[model samples]
Every structure is written in structure tokens, then in C-alpha cells.
Target: MNVTVKYFASLREKLNLSEEQLTLPQGVNQGDQLKAFLCLRGPQWQKVFQETGPLQIAINQERASWQDIFSDNDEIALFPPVTGG
Candidate 1:
């Protein structure tokens, strides 16, 4: 199925693109798995999926657990965690 993946902030700089439309294999049913799958695309993907700081994820504008699931047309976004002073 096809889904739109959006990148924001530092992630955009790292990935070098704002978004991508991909047709993922059927086994990619969860958010974290999707993250791992994207990493397989190359070094950029690896950075985005890094276990450390900066990156955060949302689904249709709401925060998602790393294990949250997704559907064929789901909209996923990647961004850095927000901070306020």
C-alpha cells in the first residue's frame, strides 16, 4: 500500500526531502517496523531512525507510539520534539 511520509526540522535536513510516497511491503504493519524499513533505504534513513535524540513521529497530526500501527493511506510525519521555555 502507498503512504505519504513527511519529514520536518532536523530530519528534513538529514533526509534532504520533505516527503515521500512509498508502496511498502505487506509486512510493514507497524510504525517502528516502518522506521526500520526506511533505514534500509540508505544512510539517511539510518540517521532518521537513530535511537537517540531529535526525532519524533506523528500520525495524521497526533503523536504516535513507536509501535503504533498504520494503514495503506495513513499519513505519517517525522519531526523533532518540541521545546518551550
Candidate 2:
């Protein structure tokens, strides 16, 4: 399936990227699976994704979790946790 992926805040800084258009291979249908697919890009990608604890996700602009499933033409946003005092 094809989808758009976005990175925000520190994740963008670390990855030096803001957005990507991807046509995923078969069997990648969930948030966690998508993340694992991205992590395969390289060590920097792995570090930015795997080392970050429970990064936030949004599916088509609505908040979602790693377990959430997504589909073609979907917009997936990933970001570090937000903390406000």
C-alpha cells in the first residue's frame, strides 16, 4: 500500500527529514510494522526510531497507537512525546 509518513519535533531533527511518500511491501499493515520497516533504512534510522520510547503516532491526523492499523493513501505522523509544564 502507499502512504505518507511525517516526522515532527526532535524526530525530524534527528532524521533530517520531514515527510516521505512510501509504497510499502506486502505484510506491513500496522504502525509498529511500518516503524520496523523504516528502521531498516540504516543505523541512524534505527537509533531514532527504536531508541525513542513509545513515539506518538497519528493516522490521517487523528491520534493513534503503535498497534493501530492503517491503509493506502493514509497519512502517518510520528513524533517524540510531548511534555508541557
Candidate 3:
């Protein structure tokens, strides 16, 4: 399926990208799976998506969990947890 992946905050800086269009493999249908697939890109990816800290995901503007499935043209945003002071 094709989806738009967006990065925010530190993730955007680290990846040196704000967003991109992704044509994902059939098996990479869930949020967690997508993250794992991205982690394969290199240590930086793994650190941001898997290791560094707690991450938040939203699908088509709604909050989503790791198991959430994606659809064609879906907009997925991944970012670090928000904090306020």
C-alpha cells in the first residue's frame, strides 16, 4: 500500500526529512511492522523508531497503536511523546 509518512520534532531533525511517500510491502501493514521495516535502514532509524525513547503514532490524524493497520493513501505521523511545562 502507498502511504505518506511524516516525522516531527527530533525525529525530523534526525532523519533529515519531514515526510515522504512510501510504497510499503504487503506484509508491512501494521504500525509496528512499518517501524520495524524502517529500522532496517540503519542505526539512526533504529534509534529513533525503536530505541531512543517512547514514540507516538497517528494515522490519518487519529491516534494509532502498534497493531493498527494502514490503508492506501493513509497519512502516518511518527514522533516523540509530547511534553508540556
The lDDT leader among the candidates is 2
Point out where model 1 deviates above 4 Å.
51-54
TM-score for each prediction?
Answer: 0.86, 0.93, 0.91
Clashing pairs in 2: none
Which of candidates 1 and 2 reaches a greater lDDT? 2
The candidate that wins on TM-score is 2
lDDT of 3 by residue, 1-85 (tens): 9999999998899889999999998899888898888988888788766554888899999999989988999999999888899
Give each prediction's root-mean-square deviation over alpha carbons.
Answer: 1.8, 1.0, 1.2
lDDT of 1 by residue, 1-85 (tens): 8899998887788668999998999889677788788889887667666843756788888899878888888899988788889
Cα deviation of 73, candidate 3, in Å: 0.7
Local distance difference test, candidate 1:
0.81
Candidate order by decreasing TM-score = 2, 3, 1
